[model samples]
Target: MADGGKVVCVTGASGYIASWIVKLLLQRGYTVRATVRDPLDAKKTEHLLALEGAKERLKLFKADLMDEGSFEQAIQGCEAVFHTASPVTFTVTDYQVELIDPAVKGTLNVLGTCTKVSSVKRVVMTSSMAAVLFPVTPLGPDYLVDESCFSDPNVCSDKKLWYVVSKTLAEDEAWRFAKENGIDLVVINPGLVLGPLLQPSLNFSVSLIADLIKDKNDTVNKNSRLVDVRDVALAHIKAYETPSANGRYIIEGPIVTINDIEKIVHEFFPELNLVDKNEASEIIPVIYKLSVEKAKSLGIEFTPTEATLRDTILSLKEKCLV
Candidate 1:
């Protein structure tokens, strides 16, 4: 797909997963119009600029999520748009301003440009698993979630699931806009994405792992799924390139408990000081499973859980992040 003239645009190019997408796109020889909040901020974009083929193939554009026409120039001639930008943070003061506005309004702003730009053929949206399930509650063992399910926004709001609410509303808006305007849209719903980050600082997902290792809290009782950041980026490309790809694809690895992660850490780094292994903690039973058959049908082989977790820790250590 990357034949030099095949241009694609990635919003929030300096982010954790988006950076990998930009890197992969540039390495494949595609002309990439990468949007950042500030293109001139060397500290944020230096790593991106240093990537292979970045000098010639990558063009940085200054774009903000809230601004109405901020992403238009970047999306002008692109064949595909990878909308990976969203305000993601666990700590929230104002849900409306911090999470909702940037997610819903920013998504509309981006898709609104697609209506004007005739060259855009497809859009691969970066939606989260949070859109599929409520944040605080675990799915029952009998409950299984696929593309068909959506998190109850009412539940999210009532429970103060701010981040989940943002993602759910944003993705809902994207689907509605695409259907109404005849724009082809594909959504990638990923679990907690973690792995080697091209960007310098640790992302929210990776930070959670760091906190877990520090044993700051007894979160071992909670069970959740994870996907490698690179795998998630690849899923975005696959969703865009595959002709038959339609609807939402859940890109997740295996469901694991926090104790499972601790076991893997012990196997990989035995010398490091870890939470007391002898501490008996109740194993959190898996409530439900996220279906990945749809993603696998598109020929995406997910990285193994152990390898994914190992790479995440090693990368954090290399960056002196953990």
Candidate 2:
């Protein structure tokens, strides 16, 4: 589909990844209808207003993920819809209240609006790799994971992996809704999303990195599969623009351990406290490798893992968040 002059709706427009999606869309000359939890929250939305062409092309709407029909007005008459709104917390007192309900209900709400708006040809969903792979177990050597894998729902509990369960269920609901209602759908499953954030505040995932820099997380056994926020954003645009794009796409970098991150940090910014040094030196085995072959088929060349880490650290430096 042609991007120029088309109207698109981005739910959770003020979020880390969504904000970058909005910026890229506006840069390409598309009219953006952006949804925020509170439209009047200047601190949350001021950066969006300052974007290029936002004065003429950006429209802000107040919407809530838990409330049905809240996104109807913003989604009407749009050519494409990006469903990026969902809870991202790893710690929660109530899984039902804090994570699961919002993710599942919010996904259904957005898809319901898409069904009503006949003009919407495609709905690009921002699903997490947590849906495809979480509560990650040790696998046989060289065992690789692709889009076909789904995080086992049985393992989820209020005390552990609630976020994983929420995303897994929400994405399943999206696919079911699309199949039953005949809505064109595309899903993006990204791992450990990181990069320079357009929004003023730090991202939840990015905050974990900040925490790591400050010697926060003591767990040293696991490794994270990282992806640049800009690459993720571009993948969203490609998913919408490419008519042949369908099903799920995994976006990620090489998985690295906490000690690896420590080495990178010390290599880049020795001025900061050495956090990873105190952790275990044994590198986590490559239990499961994520394949990005489908994303590559769509002409998405991911940024190098070293560059991704470097840029993320540099951005954190610029924000004084490190």
Candidate 3:
């Protein structure tokens, strides 16, 4: 078990989100205990090791969400824990194994271990906007989502309904556990995360942005709000250090149609000349809009809308994805 002052632990530390969380923490002079399911998976976590802080300030450890004692070492004596590890698959055949079990169980294990660690003061859980609107309520034409809305997976009628259901249940269980344990917790619910990835190998969500740039996504979602990965990481950093911060925070960037993504990038990378015919302009359907007031209240400033789009496009280009 680790015992240190102001040490932080990040689960799934090599993942797209958690990797950035670790990067932010290490840059701030915090010792980190980064957990992966298998520390020996060199191919999976090699890029993480090359990050600026991984060698001296970061310690790689093995933890399994399915195992009770696995997360204990990572959480031991840490001041903050970021629980970002979970299964998110758009094409999982079994909801029980793919979404429900890992998300719910991983949260339980991490927070359960949080209870045992004497030094832990806060837990920043990486929840999604899906927890707010899915299966449960169909977002209205003029709906602007805030902390008050919550998705009910049981009510959703879709092939990928399990992803929404698992996130909602897991987040609900987090609050239930927090209330029962008297531990302070904060949740970050961002709408459709985008931006630079620390370990981008074409994961399910990251690949969505890649697909959009290729002019491949035809099924329209009108109101697509993309939050920069840097902004989401910054939000977590702000929440983790704020002793009095509690409850849920939405990390939304801006409201734009799907075409905005193509247009913004195409202007910079004119080689592709990405554009849509004006005929199908009304095809994009709005899903949900998340409020960023609470997160802004915590000193999390967002990038200007123009810069947000430009930076996202540049980051995607740096990866040679477009």
C-alpha local distance difference test of each model: 0.87, 0.86, 0.79
**Per-candidate clashes, comma-separated:** 0, 0, 3
lDDT, residue 223, model 2: 74
lDDT of 1 by residue, 42-146 (tens): 978998999998988899999999999999999999999999999989788888999999999999999999899999999999999999977445578877778
Order of all candidates by lDDT, from best down to worst? 1, 2, 3
TM-score of 3: 0.90
Candidate 2 per-residue lDDT over residues 51-127, each given as its tens digit:
99899999999999999999999999999999999989877899889999999999999999899999999999999
Global fold similarity of model 2 (TM-score): 0.94
Tell me, by TM-score, which candidate is best.
1
Q: Which 10-residue span in candidate 3 carries the lowest summed lDDT? A: 273-282
> Which residue segments of model 2 deviate by more than 4 Å?
1-3, 134-138, 219-221, 276-279
Off by over 4 Å in 3: 1-5, 135-137, 141-144, 157-160, 219-221, 273-280, 283-290
- TM-score against native, each model: 0.95, 0.94, 0.90
What local lDDT does model 1 show for residue 153? 86
Tens-digit lDDT track of model 3 for 46-151: 8788888678888889998888879998888788999999887867777788789899988998999999898998999999987887634468767878887878
